[model samples]
Target: MHIETQLAQHRVTGLRAQADAHRLSTEAKPPVELRTRVGWTLVELGLRLASAPGPAPAVA
Candidate 1:
């Protein structure tokens, strides 16, 4: 199923925050790199959680 618009907005906001954080960094790492890393990290976590087993059926 597709993510809701609100959820998509939230994700976009989070990514912007992450990008901003990297933008403030004085290190050699670039903002684009930070954005990609953070985005991929979120995707990886989501995938892992989605793959996790959930509750099974109860007795009839």
Candidate 2:
């Protein structure tokens, strides 16, 4: 193949890949509000676990 034809094919392939990536990203992501709420819930759970008392020491 000619160099110019090869370059054009490469450009087309790159553009198609970029379009696919953009479509997947937009379609697969959860809504921002839901994501934020879930993130905060996880943070709260982590904080609670961290602050909770440890188990009592085992007797010999």
lDDT of 1: 0.87
Worst 10 residues of 1 by lDDT: 23-32
What is the number of backbone collisions in each predicted candidate, taken in the order shown?
A: 0, 0
lDDT winner: 2
Residues 1-60 of candidate 1 have per-residue lDDT tens digits of 356988999999999999988877757654578888899999999999999998997989
**Alpha-carbon lDDT of model 2:** 0.97
Best by TM-score, which number? Answer: 2
* Local accuracy of candidate 2 as per-residue lDDT tens digits, 1-60: 999999999999999999999999999997779888999999999999999999999999
- How far in Å is the alpha carbon of 57 misplaced in model 2? 77
Cα lDDT for residue 33, model 1? 81
Go through the candidates in order and give each one's C-alpha lDDT.
0.87, 0.97
Q: Candidate 1 at residue 1, lDDT?
A: 39
RMSD, every candidate, angstroms: 15.6, 6.5
